[model samples]
Every structure is written in structure tokens, then in C-alpha cells.
Target: MGARRGFQEAVLAIVKKIPPGKTLSYKDVAGRAGNPHAYRAVGSILNRYDAKKWHIPCHRVVRSDLPAPRPGLYFVYAVLCGNGAIYIGQTGNLQKRWMQHRNGTASDYTRRYGARQLFHYEQHGSREEAVQREKWLKTGFGRKWLKREWKAGRTRQAGGTPGGYRWGSKRKLHLLKKEGAL
Candidate 1:
């Protein structure tokens, strides 16, 4: 990879280390990436991340508040749904919540969706921190901003495995075989 792409990949590698049920602000990732003050740049990189449907799990990186994105939270919601992440009652108990999801004791949203693993996570401190951040994410042009990029295909969804970029679904494959369309 080129130097810039290499740096970005290195940044994303650190991002992928964040555990489930946790969160991190853009500043957090920037600091971790050795830039310390590149929060806006980090946001820009994340927003323009093209490998979402493949190698990167950008959905887990929220604005520290874990707020659902706008245009109805479908991208985040669908991803979370697709992963079967359970809802934790307390943000402070992130580790415990993640364990529940890992162990298959997650919330209704997670169960029906068959989401089980956390591909990435970010640490956003306490419940208060998460709530405040969530509030900011919901207001302003957050939803519109996210949706435009999401619809434009920046955020790709993996059908069979988490972060895997295979283009076809097993069900689709099966149906095609049955119909002799393959």
C-alpha cells in the first residue's frame, strides 16, 4: 500500500482493536494513531472510508455518545442488527454487555438479527459521556450527512461474514441454483 493508505490502514488497525460495548471519540482514535490532535481529520477519514463493506468496521466508531445516526439509523441499525449486538442497559458496564453478546445472551435486537461478534469497538468513557455524545450526533446535520454517504455506497454490507466483502448471499446462491440461473 502507498504511504497514505498505509497510515490509514494502521489507524484502522488500531480502531479494530477497540472492544465491543465500548466507544471512542474521534479524538481518541487520533491520539491513539499518534496524531493526538487530528480529531477532525480522523472524522474525515472515517467518513470517507471506502472499505466499510469489507475490511473496516466503521459503524462501531461513533461520536463517543453511541448515538444512532440519522435518516432513521438504518445503516448503523442494520449493521448492528446484522451483527446481532445486544443492548446493554448501562454504558458503564460495557465489558459485561459485550460478554453477553458474545455468549448469546444479548437483547431482542441482537437475537433476531443473529449478530454475535463485535468486529470493532471504541471507548467513550462513562454513561454520561456516551449520552452527551449521542445527543450531539442526533442533532444538526448528522443524520443527513451520514445517509448521503451511506447511500452513495461508502458503507458496504457484508452478507455472509462480518466484514467479509463477498457480493452474493447464500440464500441467493441457493435460489439461483434451484432456478438454474447460476
Candidate 2:
């Protein structure tokens, strides 16, 4: 515990030196603390400390990779939570966003609802299209349509196809491959 506490103190000291409007990645902080591989530990330390009291800018320590939306095919995806509720969201990187949800860092809704798996997705040419689709999916008519489609596909009979998916116990590829879906 002494060594661990030393590392935490080192992280806070490093963060305290970050210039205003500047940032350092978690990896950078860990490396400065004499442990290149303890990046996650740096993040943990930052999250556990109070920046105001410590006079440390903990928020300046961020992930090595920024969250700028990648330019590519955007998607409006749905996750079927363990609670039998659906979550609608739009993202440029579906896989990364899905991972965040799976890790319970994506949103309070997913974390609270226990997001189970990717229920559905629709690819779009532009961000606007994905945003529009996501907005529509949150409406009464859109939700009804998703339910109707899910019922038609009979996805309750679980087991993944080819793409990695799991809804409830598992998810089906055939349902995802259906027209107008992903």
C-alpha cells in the first residue's frame, strides 16, 4: 500500500504541473511516475482524488486517444439491455462506442439498465442522417417499429451468427441482416 500510495501521489504531482488549457494522456502520467505500463493505474488515481483540494487538475489527465468522432460511415445503433429495454444512440465508431457501453462507461442509462448486446444498427452516409435516425428511434412510432421488427425476426431464439452480438443470452445475425437494418 505504501508503494501504491506513492504512485498516486506521483500522478497528482504530475497533473498539478499541467499548464492551463493543456492536457496529458494517462500513459504520459504513468511514464513520468516511473511505470510506463501503469497507465490504467494513473487514471484510477486521478479519478480517486479530489482535484480542488489537492490543487491538481485531474481532468487534464485523459485517454491517450481523443474522442473526436472519426470521419466515416455513421451509425444509429440499438442495444437491448438486460432489463428488456432498448437504448438508442449514434456514433461514428460503432465498435468503440459499443465497447464503452459494454464496459459501463458509455452512459448512465446503459450502466443502470445493464446493456446486454447490440440489438440493431443502421449505417448512414452522414452524421446528420445518423442523428436524425437516432432521434426518430427514440420516438413512440420509431420504438414501435423496432419492436415490430424484432418480433418479426424472432430474435428471442438466441445465439450469435457471424458478427459479435449478444442480446439477453445471445443475438442472431439473421435478424441484423434483415433489410433496412445492419
Candidate 3:
């Protein structure tokens, strides 16, 4: 937490400040960390971030040249597991990935927490865009966006619970919103 002077510490601290659905290029993070020319160093520092720790959303750091994703080939998807968990993922081959999830071979998280129903999916321009979008969908902003979509009737399902991260089914979410309980 004391990264006021240490470059590595500063880089991480700055990265932790990046909001969900928002991003900063590697170079931008380096500059903010007090070293204008250490973009590579920022990447390396982020590489060391422990996945076990919180407040480090390193995936939000994008390449300097990318102006965000464009629009087509790849996909970003969300699945509603039986336990009320929403899993977000990206894939170039949507059908293949769907098969994997169905067979419980996609991820341990999905296998253990979800029955694997395709609740939402969106198109992206490339693999990079899919990856970034997957990360975004795991954030609060993405959830709210989905909620808005539900409200607009473009979608009928979503994820979130009152007391914990695990939410109920699509029907439950809809009822909660209707009764103004959510």
C-alpha cells in the first residue's frame, strides 16, 4: 500500500484506480506512476500481481495502439449457472466454446458453480476485444448495462443478488425489479 515512491508500487496503485468498463494504456499507467517512459515496466509489474489478491484489475490495461475494440468476428459471453453465478468469457469460436461449457470442460468455476445456461452474449471485432469485453462483463458497470437492457426489453435475464455475489434466476431478478426490491 506504500507505493508513493516505489515505481512498482506506484504502478499497481495506479492500476487499482482504473474503473470498471474503463481502461488506461500501459504507457499511460507508467506515466501516472511517475515514469513517463516505463510502459514495459508497468506491464511486467502487472504480471506479478497475485490473482489471489483483490483491487488489481490488470486486464483493464490495454495496448497503447488499441482504441478499444472495433466490431465483429469474436464474442464475449455470459452464462447463468444453476447456483445463481454469472460466468463471463470470450471465444473466437462460439459454438465450440458453448460445447465445452455444456460438457463441463470449460472452466472449474462454471463446473462447480453453474449448470451452464447461455444468458447473454455479444459480438466483438477481435480476440482482443472479446477479452476486454469479458473483463468488462465481470464488472459492476457491465451488470448495470445488462440491467438497463432488461429494462428496455432487449434482454430478459441478468445476474446479481441482494446479500451476496450469487444471484437467483432470471425470473427472480425480474420479480425483484418489478416489486422495486432490487
Report, for every candidate in turn, its global Cα lDDT versus the true structure.
Answer: 0.45, 0.65, 0.60
| Candidate topping TM-score | 2
lDDT per residue, candidate 1, 88-166, as tens digits?
2324443335434433365665545534333223245455655655454455564454455556856433221312113
User: What digit string (tens of lDDT, one per residue) describes model 2 on residues 1-182?
Assistant: 99888888788888888764334556668989989899888867766665567676554444433233467788788788857899889889765676566546789987776555576777788999999989998999999998898879843322112222222112322332231122
TM-score result, candidate 3: 0.43
Which whole-number lDDT from 0 to 100 does residue 16 have in model 1? 73
Query: Following a full C-alpha superposition, what root-mean-square deviation does model 3 have from the true structure?
Result: 16.1
Which residue runs does candidate 2 get wrong by more than 4 Å?
1-70, 154-182
* Rank list by TM-score: 2, 3, 1
Worst 10 residues of 3 by lDDT: 158-167
True lDDT of residue 111, candidate 3:
59
Q: In model 3, what is the error at residue 1, expressed in angstroms?
A: 75
Cα lDDT, model 2, residue 129? 91
- lDDT score of residue 78 within candidate 2: 79
